[model samples]
Target: MKRYLFIMSLIALLGACAKKEGKFDRADGTAAITVASLENHLKILASDAFMGRMPFTEGEQKTIAYLQEQFKNLGLESGNGSSYLQEVPMVEITTTAAPVMEVKSAKKKFTLEGLKDYVIWTQRTDPTTEVKDTELVFAGFGIVAPEYNWNDYEGLDVKDKVVVVLVNDPGFGAEDVSLFKGNTMTYYGRWTYKFEEAARQGARGILIIHDDVPAGYGFWVVQNSWNASKLYLDTRGKDLYFSAFTGWVSQPAAKKLFEEAGIDWASTVSAARKPGFKAVPMKLSITTSLVVKAKYDKSHNVIGKITGAKQPDEYIIYSTHWDHLGIGKPDEKGDTIYNGALDNASGTAGMLELIKAFKNMENKPNRTVVFLAVTAEEQGLYGSEYYAQNPVYPREKTVANINMDGINPYGRMKDIVVVGIGQSDLEDYLDAEAKAVGRYTSPEPNPVAGYYFRSDHFNFAKVGIPALYTNTGIDHHEKGADYGKQLQDEYVSKYYHKPSDEYDTSRWNLEGAAEDLQLLFNVGKKLAFETSWPQWKKGSEFKSTREQYMPKVN
Candidate 1:
């Protein structure tokens, strides 16, 4: 009897060890995320059949169906209560401006040519929007920051007038760090905010003077939107309404207007940059009318989920915007499709690859992991904004967010660049994962460009969710930063936002992309099993909101 008992006990112990080892085995799962798998998904998604993946079109239907099918095949539960799609209702605003908009002054008058000297559009859905002989007010930077003690529109009445403002904040060219986050753009510096503030001030319209140094991109970038339509989330019932017109005028055109008003352009600009600068009237009247056509439609944000075994309420979200610029004008080679192979198709494929990695793991997550592919990102982050505003899961229960906008097609890197550095503890998690694989973390080269506010991740960050956006480090593995820069410049000049953005096997190598996806997977994996909720770092604009709202979540 004693011998039999001993043998039985030994067998039980061995069985327990085997089960534990199997559950903890992490090797095969990590290997599942591979270059070939990512490439396959990327190539298929970027194919011509996808039609550039525009929202509210046949392409959107096909793209969403493909995502849903992939999730179903992987056995992922629907993230939106038995449905993978979250409908994002949006409005399309198509504005057509007259050829010549006249500018008038007491002394003399001149006409501004549309699409050349100025470009204007209307946000209102009304059939006709007018800016008829509205007086122009030079509101400096158009900022009203109580914290910075700056108010350009203080004691000014801009009603029924056009507010002409500079593109960037006053501190953009300042040498003093004390001046409004000096040289680094504050939220007030954004063009979107300019329109928002103008509406609040009861202005009829707002025109931003375009300067390449302050705007980051060149004027040609602005010129591309001469008469293009725009997509925006529908807020018809909201009390806040947008101004009738929002526009941009070239630097030379603005200077000519200043001259016509007898205001010294150089001295006026200098005074605007200093503190205590008040609004200056251009005394110039402008008249323009925009024929507006509006339509309402719905786009979908696709979501897939892996429910947790232990704590289903806690979650980690991975985000990617799946939409890109659809078919448009033909390029020199007659290619009309703006196949955004690198912009986001590559990143979306990486998210799908992550799903495979998580599914392959023997151990189920302790906290749920969510894969979210949002839409209408090319039209301005509307999809992610909708999700963030109306989250499927409570934001408090969410642990962290990892966002992939573009994966590096250049080979492996020695470092991964972090955008919006020092925003959260997510950086620590990424640093750990990168170091384990003998890579390092570095800050982005242009932190002042406000890249953190550009991608879908910004929507998550805006709602106090601790989020991280990373770029492939410019420091290449074999070559130096110069080589990496040359490649990026090529992408910008040759393919960025152009019909020639289609994938070419000769140009791209997915080894780096695969490695990037793996790193993100590890970060998500760590958060999946962990119990601690990551906090936004102190001094972050979003930290206070996180602390205030966390306890209120059910």
Candidate 2:
């Protein structure tokens, strides 16, 4: 009997030592993040049969059902108690704007063609959204950040007026790195923020002057979105405020507005960038109307989780938006459904790969791992916003958020791009894992583009969570950086937000995506086992928000 007891104790010791989570496997598929696994998932998710995976349609029904089935098959517990679906109340608004938007200055008058010179949309459920000769105020960047000592609407009463704002923040082209995030764009710079601030300041309407370089994408992206039906979180009971019209104007149209006001375009641009710049009324008014048709519905955010072996209450999250632009205006090839293959299908696939990687491990994590596939990212991140506002897990106990937006379809990269690099300590975890595999971390080249605040991860970041969002590196291992840049540029110009964004096996090689996923999996793997919590960096905008919930010991 004593001999038997000793043998059992010896066997238990060996098993415990063998289950070390610090192996830090360097090989790509060693952690189950293989190229084959990614391709197989992407093929089905990006297939036309999914009908572009739009919310409130058959596509959403099929997509969510598939994810739920996959979750059950993978042996993951339903993240929401006893169910994977978290119902999101939504309202779809389709706005039809008048073709010609008449602009009248005190001295002169002009008319700009809609869908070309400008595009307008409304979020209100009201049948008619009309702005009749609303005064235009050029609120420089339309920011009201007390930290930067900047408030463009300070001396100006823009109530019931249309505020025309620049697309980016002040530090976009500034020589000084001290100015608001320097060249890196902040939350203040986002067009969504501009509209929000305008509404907060009692403005009835607002128009953003769209410049291609600062706006990231071309005017066609705006035209594509506003011209189509839009989805917003249903806030019927709450007193929600939206401008009469949230719109964008072409550069030429904005220049014409300034010229008509006798406000020198060059001088206004110069003054806008300065620290003490104030709001200027263009002495012009915009006249346009929108016929709005809104309908209420429910969308589901499919969620799954692997409970922790030790600290079950503490959680780490992996997120992706499982949605794209659905059937819309046909392209030249007569394709109406926007596949969104590279935009998000790849990302959703990658998130699944991470979950599989975690599930395959013999040694379960110390903290819980939550896998969230959200809805309606293309319609302005409503799904994630819903989750952030109504999380299944407590925000204080949730450790970090690792988000995948789009994975690299090109082959292996020499480095990985870290968007919003200095925001959190989560990047440090990623850097360590990336270095283990002999690759390097690179900061995003276009910091002023504001890629950080554009995606679902931004929703998590907004509420004090330290979120990590990385992209495929530009420096290709075999092909040069120029070649990588060319491929990316082509996709942005040709396929981004278009029906042509289908999964092309001919153009895509998931080797790079596999490596990137392996790295991300390793980061989450480390976080899951360790007790250390990743925090927002000292100077990060989210740092204070985080500190409110998680105070530092020191």
Candidate 3:
């Protein structure tokens, strides 16, 4: 009897050990995120049949349907209360015809070729809009930020006149540490901010001078994006305030115009960087006309949610833009479709895979996790901007947003780049998770690019939500930073925003993307269960907005 009892006790101990190992196995959940599955999804989504997944067309219908079907299969509830689609009303305007802009001065009359020397478009809805003899004023940066105590429009009455402005802020252009966060771009540096400020100043026209460094991308990106039809959110049929004509002038053209006014172009740019700099009238008048075609339609934002076990009203949002530049002017290779494989198709697929992972979790979250695939990101983040304004989940209840825009397809990395680092407590959470996997986080190498303000998360961040946007780092585990940077440079120069952005299985190693997805999944999982709210960092511009919406309580 003693021998039998001892044998039974030994078997019991072995069984207990087995149970513990199984319970703690990380693969149990991570297995749900497979590189093969992600590849398959990308193959279908990025295929030419989807017509580049542009919103408000046959392509949009197919894309949204696929998202809805997948979300339904995962048993996720519709985020829009019984509907997976959120209608985003938009206005599409195509410039049917625009002639070369003619600038007249007493010294000489100059004619600049449209689409070559300058690209211009209007925000007004009128079928025919013309600017005749509009006096051009050279505004420093077209910035008026009260917080920074900077106002470029200080001593200038730009009413009914045209304003020529620099692309980025004075601080960014000069790299001066004392100016507006130094090399890091503030909201005042964004082109959108410049346009809005121009309108507020009652300027009839606005032109931005393009330089590669300050603008982050080459002139080709601006030329291509601005040459096509533009889309904007249609807000309740209200007349939106926009300049008569908004445009970008090639660097050469801007220099020629400044020289025509007997001003040293280089010296003027230098002076613009100084405080108390006054606007310089170019003493030239521009005349331009446009014939436009306008159409109004509704695009859709695909939304799905998993309700929590406890605080269902509170929400953690995962967002990615699903739209790309549709069929447009052909590239050199004659490929017209912008497949957008890396730009956002990777992000969209990652979102779906993440949804699957969360659904397969051992236990449901304690607060709701909402998956949002927005539209019109390529057209100035319209879909997200609309959703931020009319949120399916109340802004006050919305806890945080983890946005994935571009996922690295290359191999694993030793570090990750936080696009907008030092903005919120979310960075601490990300660092903790990254450290667990023997990795670390770094600030974006090119802060002057204003990439933080460029992605879809900016809309959520604008409303005080702690939004996180990180990218794969340049420091590759095996190849090092040089190889990683080479790949990134190649993508930007050869494929970014072009039809060549299709996926190449041979080149893509999705291990890094899977790791990123896992990190994001863990972050959202923690936020879903915790009662603590992540606050924006002390000096962050968004801190006051957070305080207003979610006031700290003792």
Candidate 4:
């Protein structure tokens, strides 16, 4: 009887040990993801069937449907007031193509061919708007940045005149690295800011010169993007301001215009760098007209939330833009759909995988996890901006926002590139999580492009929430950092903003992407349990805003 009892006791002890080991093992905790999962998700998201996930089209419908289905499968709750769809009111303005832009000058009249030398668009809601013989004015960089102590529009009334400006800031060409982050494009250097400032100055039109390096991408990118069907959030209800016309001039076209005005283009650019430079009257006038059809449409932001077991009110948000450049003018091979496989399909899929990982966790997070797949990121971060302005949850209660824009297809690496590295304490969390996985965190390789302010996270950051956006590092397992950088450069030159950016399982290494996602998950997981609120880094533009906006705990 004693021997029989001993055998039963030993069997029970061994069974308990096996169960404990199975629970602790990473493989047991979650199923190992197959490359097939990533490929399958990308195939559908970037498929020609989805029409490139454009915001205001049937494609938007199909894309949102697929996302909703996925969220349902994951058992996540609807994030938008008992529904998964968040209504985003938008207006679609399609401008009839203009044939030619005539610039009349004192010495000669030059006609700029549309699409060949320049591309122009209008922000006005009117059916027809004309800029008839508007006077031309050189408005320096067309920037009015107080932070940099630079105001290009100072002491100048550019009203009712066409403002011609440099592509980047004054400190760009200067030898001093300390001057305006030399060579790096500041927020003032962004074309969006330039156009907005022009409108605020009451200019009739704004024209920006295009350069490859300072602008990050080549002139062809700008041409292609502007030529595509443009989408903008409906500001009809709001008192938004814009000039009569907004456009870009090719380098050659700009040179001819300046030469016709008897102004040396190179010398004027140099002179603008000096202190207290006045606007140069070009003695020229620009004439153009736009015919528009305004249609009100609605876009949806896909949101799903996993409620916290304890602190359900406090939240951590994970976001990625789901929209891309939709069907447009055919490419060389007659491919109209901009697949955007790498531009964002990869990031979208990563967010889905993150949802899976979070759901698999044994202990539910203390803070609710909100998975937000926003729309119209390509259209100047409009979806995120709308969400920030009208949040389902209070912005103060939201602990942090982690954004994924473009995920690296090339496998695992030794480091991660934090877009806004020094702006918040979020980097410290990411650094520690990365170190645990044998990786480190670094700043963006090309900071001058102002990548920090480019992605969806910037919208949350602007509203005083600590936001994080990181990309795959340059270092590669088989090829090292140089080769990884070369790959990135090749993509920028060849595939970026092109229809050729489709998915290929053979070339992609999702191992690196999975690792990055795991690290991101860890960061959120740690924060979800912490009792202390994460603060923005000192001296950051957002720090003071947080102090003013967020409720004090003391």
Clashes of each: 0, 0, 0, 1
Tens digit per residue, CA lDDT, model 1, 375-478: 99989999999999889998988888899998998888888889878779999999988998888888877767888888998888878899999997787988
How do the residues 286-360 of candidate 3 rate in per-residue lDDT, one tens digit apiece?
898888787899999999999987789999999999988778879999999999999889999999999999888
Q: Which candidate number maximizes lDDT?
A: 2
Please give the ranking of all candidate structures by lDDT, highest first, separated by commas: 2, 1, 3, 4
The total of clashing pairs for model 4 equals 1
**Residue 225's lDDT in candidate 2:** 66
For model 4, how does the per-residue alpha-carbon lDDT over 213-325 read when each residue is reduced to its tens digit? Answer: 66767778767766455677788778777887898888888888888888998889888886577789999997888888888888989999988766889999999999998
- The estimated TM-scores of all candidates read 0.89, 0.88, 0.87, 0.84
Better candidate number, 3 or 4, judged by TM-score? 3
RMSD of each: 4.2, 3.5, 6.1, 6.0
Candidate 3 stretches greater than 4 Å from native: 1-31, 96-113, 155-157, 217-221, 225-227, 255-267, 281-284, 328-337, 552-554
Residue-by-residue lDDT tens digits, candidate 2, 450-554: 889989999999899999999889999887675677787888889999999999989899999998998888888788878888888866778777888885746
lDDT score of model 2?
A: 0.87
